[model samples]
Target: MRSYPVDSPHAAGRILALTMIVDGNLVGSELAALSRSKILDHIDLDHADFQHLLKDLCEDLLTSTSHGAIQVDNALIDSVLEEIVHPDLRRSLLHAMWSIADADGWLADAEAVLLTRASNAWAAETNFSSPSYRRP
Candidate 1:
């Protein structure tokens, strides 16, 4: 998979893209939820750029799935999550991911695993001493 610079908008968009496809299908509701979240604006990524990032992610996944199986293990996830070191960006991405996961009204096992992994990883990396720090 192509790697973006740490904390770059493309890196952030990649994580969001993974969230959209991890469940094996990208539904309309998930896209709608992403649009409503306005996370792209926060990350300084426009819709067009985000779409490009999504396409890149899909291509990478497809290329890696030569055996007819897509392997998205925790180590791969950690590598992606490691790109976003900013606490605020991590929080925003996490919230957007949750919104997308729940948008279809049924959270699949893959979605739950991704969400939990991201939340736990980010939580451990961030200092939660501030009173304003809240898990999204």
Candidate 2:
């Protein structure tokens, strides 16, 4: 995957896009939830830019595919997760991810895996003890 500056809008958008596709399908409900939440605006990313980032992420993942199956590199995902350094940004992004995962009314195992991985990774860097971080 192409590199973007730490905490850059592109990085944030890429992560969000990854969340949308982690389940191997991008549903309309997920897109609608993202649009309604306006989370991209929080990172100064417009819808057009977000779509571009999503496309770029898809291309990157496709390039790394082997034998017709996409094998996502954990190191690459970690690097992208590390790009968002701010605690507030991490929290917001996590929230957006959870929202997207739940948008279709069913959380696939793949979605849960990505969400758990991101939450654990970010929790190690920042204090997530607050009740807000708890799932209802």
Q: List the residue pairs that clash in candidate 1.
A: none
lDDT of 1 by residue, 54-105 (tens): 9989888888874799988778888898999999888899999999999999
Q: Candidate 2 has which clashing residue pairs, if any?
A: none
- How many residue pairs of model 1 clash at the backbone? 0
Candidate 2 off by > 4 Å:
131-136
Q: Rate the local accuracy (lDDT) of all candidates.
A: 0.91, 0.89
Alpha carbon lDDT at 36, candidate 1 = 99
Q: Local error of candidate 2 at 131, Å?
A: 11
For 15-127, candidate 2 gives per-residue lDDT tens digits of 99998997789999999999988898899999999999999999988998889988665777788898998899999999999999999999998788788889999998888
lDDT of 1: 0.91
TM-score of candidate 2 to 2 decimals: 0.92
Weakest 10 consecutive residues, lDDT, candidate 1? 126-135
